[model samples]
Target: MSSINGKTIWVTGASSGIGKSLALKLSSYQCNLILSSRNKEELLKVKELCGGSNTISILPLDLTNHHQMEEIAEKAISKFGSVDMLVNNAGISQRSLIIETKVEVYEQLMQINYLGTVALSKAILPHFIANKSGHYVTVTSLMGKFGSPYRSGYCGAKHALHGFFDVMRMEHEKDGVKVTLVCPGFVQTNVAKNALTADGSPQKDDDVATQNGITPELAAKKMISAIEKGKFEVYIGGKEVKGIYLKRFFPKLLHKVVLKSHVR
Candidate 1:
C-alpha cells in the first residue's frame, strides 16, 4: 500500500460529487491537490470545504475544449512541479436510445468522455515518462463493460477508454506508469442531471438509485485504498455493480434479468 501524504495529485471534475469528496479526503492527508472543473465558483467552494488552503489549488478547466488541454496540462504541472497522479474523473453520460439519439449527441459524448481524457493523459505522458512514475485513476461506469439500454453512445465511449488505457498500461509497465479504471454503479452526483439526452439536451437529473448508492466520501476512501494497493481496476458501489461480473459469466441469465429490470 502507498501513502497519499505529500503525493502531488490532480483531480478533474472537482466541482462536485466524487471529485469534490476526493479533494476533501486528500486534503486531510496533507496531499498537494490541484482541482479542475468547468465551474470555477463551485470548485472554490469545494476547495474551502477541503480545509487546506495551503495544500489545495483550483484551476478551472473544460475537458471538452480539445484545443485547451495542453494549456491545462501546463498549468497543472507548473503548480505541482510534477504530478505524481491524475484522477481523470471528468465526463458526461448519455441516457437516450440509439435510434432517438442525435449524431451530435454521440459526438459530444465521445469528445468529452473519450477524447478529452486521452488528451490529458497524453499531455502528461512525457512528464511521467521522464520521472519514471505516475498513476492514472479514471472514473468509468459499469456500463462500459455491460451495455445498457438507452446508453449506446455512453457505453461506446466508456468501452473505448478501457481499450486505450489498457494499451497504455501494457506499453508503459516498465516505465513505472500505473492506471486504475474505476467502474462505479449509481453514484449520487450531478452527472445524471448533466447526462446527455436524445436531442443533446441535459437529462434533468433523475437518479433513482443514487439514494442507496455509497456516499462520495466513502467512495473516495475506497478509491484511495485501491491506489495505495496499486490495483489495476476496481468497482465501487452497492451490489448493483455485481452485474458487471455476472454479465460476463452468466450472459444469458443476466440478459433475461436485465430485460425485466427497471434500470432506465
Candidate 2:
C-alpha cells in the first residue's frame, strides 16, 4: 500500500469539482493537504470545509503560469517539510469543432493542459528524487487515449500528457517515484461549462452527459483507491470506460462508435 494516510498530498484545482471532493475525502485520512487553485476565496472555503485545521493549507495556483511552478513547488515542500504526492488535476477543457476553432485556442489548450502540467511536475521532480519517493496522480480525460470530434485540441493535450508521464515513469521508477494516470469518462463537474469554445470563450453552459455523470465524490474515492494500489493507469466511469479497450484493439470500431455517440 502507498501509505498515503500519514504523508502530505498536494492537489491542484482544489477549489471545486473532483479536486474539492478529493480534498474533503483525503481529510479523513489524517494526511497533510495543500489545496491549490486560481480561486483563493473558494480555496479558503474548501479549507474551512475540511475542518479549517492546520493540517490543511491553501496555495492559490494558476497552471498556465508555468514559470512560477518552481517557486510554488518550493513553497509547497516547505509547508510540511516534504510532499509525498502531487495530484495534477488542474486543467481546462474544450468544446469546439476543428474547423471552427482558432489556432489560439489550440495554443492555449497545450499551454494550460500539457506544458503547464509538465512544468509543475518537473519543478517537483528533484525533491522526489532526493527523497527517493513520490507519486504523481494526473486526472486526464478518456479523450487522452483516443481522438474526439469536438475536443480536438483537448484530446491532443491530454494525449501529450500520457506520453510525457509514461517516459517520466520509465526513468523515475528506480528513484522510488510512481505515476498514476487517471482517465475519467465523466463525473459531474463544471468541465463543460468552463470549456473553451471556438473563439476561446468559455462555453458557460451545462452539458447533459456531464450533468448526468457520476458524482465528483465518487470519482475522488476511486482515484484515491487507484493511488493507494499504485496503479500505472486506471479508468473510471460507466460504459464509457470500454472505449479504452476499443481504442486499443479495435480502433476503427471505437472511432465509429464515438462518431455515432456524437460526443460534444
Candidate 3:
C-alpha cells in the first residue's frame, strides 16, 4: 500500500486544474481529504467526483484573506483530527509586460501567491510541530526558477515560495516536517485564461504552450510519486523544464533563446 493511502491531506485550489486532479487521484488511495478553494460549489462537485471509501470534506478558502488563515487551519485540523499534509496549490498567473503592469497587480500577486501561502503555512506549523510529522507540498512554476517575458509579478511570487519553503525545510527537519516544491512547466490548465493582463483583466484566452501541455492527470501522478518518495523538489512538463538547467550552466545562451522564443 502507498504511504499516502490512509493519510489525511488538505489540498487548496481544489476547484479545478491540478488541484482537482490530485483530489481525484488521492481518493483512490483511501485518503481522508480536505479540499479548499474560493468556490464551495465547485469544491462540492469535486468531492462528489471523488466517490470512494475515503472521507472528503470541503473547506472554502480565500488565500487572499490572510487574516483568516489561522482560524481556517484550526477548522481543517478539527475535521480529521490531524492533517498529514497540506498542499499549497492555490495561485493566480500573470500575462502582462512589466512596463505596462500596474503596481497594484504586483501587490495582488504577492498578497495571494506569496503572503497568503505563508500565512496558511504558519497557521499549520504548530500542529505539525506538536505531532512531529507533516508535509508541505507546494505547486510553484517553471517561472519560479527562471524569469520569463510578461510574467514578472508571477515569477516573483513563485520565487518567493521557493525561498520560504527552502528555509522551512531546513528549520523543521529535526521536527520531521518535510517540504516539496513542485515546479510545473505547463499542464493543460486554464491558468492562462485566468491570468491577469496589464490592465488587471483576465487574458480570456489560452496560450499555445499551455494548450499543448500534458494533462493534469499526468502531472498529478508525477507529483504523487515525488511526494511518496519524500523528494524535496520535482519538475513536471515538456521542454520548458530545460530552461532551468540552461539557466544554471548557460545563462547567456538561455537568455538569447528566451528572447527569440517570443513567449506570450
Candidate 4:
C-alpha cells in the first residue's frame, strides 16, 4: 500500500491540469481529499470523476486573495480533522517578454504564484508543527530553475518559491515537516492558454511546447513517487528538464542555447 493511503490531503488548483490529475491519482490510494479551486462547479466535476463522494470534498478558493488563506487553511483542516499534506498547486503563468510586460503583471504573478503559496503554507505551519508530521508539495516549473524567454515574470515567481520553500524546509526539519518542490518542464494543460500577456490579458492560445508535452496523469505519478520517497526536489517533463542540468553544469553553453532557441 502507498504511504499516502488514508492521509488527508488538500490540493489547490484541483479544477485542472496537474492538480486534477493528482487528485484522481490519490483517490485510488484511498486518501481523503479536500479539493480547492476558484471554480466550484469544476471542482465538483473533478470530485465526481474521482468517484468517491465520501472521500472527496470541494472547497472553492482564489489564491490571489492572500488575506483569506488562513481561514481557508482552517476550513481545510476542519474538513478531515487535520490535513496531513498540502499540495500547493494553484498558480498562474506569464507569456510576455520582460520589457513588454507591465509592472502590474509582475505583481500579479508574484501575488498568485509566489506570495499566495507562501501565505497558505504559513497558515498551515501551525497545524503541521503541532502534529509533528506533515508534508508540503509545491508544483513549481523547470523555469524556476532557469530563465526562459517570454517567461521572465513566470521565472521570477517560480524562482522565489525555491528560495522560500528551501528556508521552510530547513527551519521546519526539526518539526518533522517535509517540503518537496516539484518542477515541471511542461505537461499538457491550459496553462499556456491562460498565461498573462504583456497587457495583462490571457494569451488565449497554447504554445507548441505545451501542446507536445506529456500527459498530466504521467506527471502526477512521478510526483507521487517523489513525495513517497521524501525527495527535497524533483524535475519532471520531456527534454526540457535537461535545461536544468545544463544550466547547472554548463552555464555558458546553456546561455547560448537558450538565446538561440527563441522559445515561445
lDDT of 4 by residue, 98-136 (tens): 888899999999999999999999999999999998999
Estimate the overall C-alpha local distance difference test score of candidate 4.
Answer: 0.94
Model 1 C-alpha lDDT per residue in residues 192-257, reported as the tens digit of each score: 788899999998867777666788888888888898888988988998787887888998887877
Q: Of the candidates shown, which would achieve the greatest lDDT relative to the real structure?
A: 3
Candidate 1: C-alpha RMSD after superposition: 1.3
lDDT of 1 at 19: 89
**Candidate 4 minimal-lDDT segment of 10 residues:** 255-264
Runs in model 2 with CA error above 4 Å? none
Each candidate structure's TM-score, on Cα atoms with residue i matched to residue i, is 0.96, 0.98, 0.98, 0.98
Sort by lDDT, top down from the best: 3, 2, 4, 1
Q: lDDT of all predictions, in order shown?
A: 0.87, 0.94, 0.95, 0.94
User: Which lDDT tens digits does candidate 2 get at residues 1-264?
Assistant: 346878999999999999999999999887999999999999999999999999999998988898999999999999999999999999999999899999999999999999999999999999999999999999888999988788999999999999999999999999999999999987899999999999999999988889888999999999999998899999998888999999999999998998898777
Off by over 4 Å in 4: none
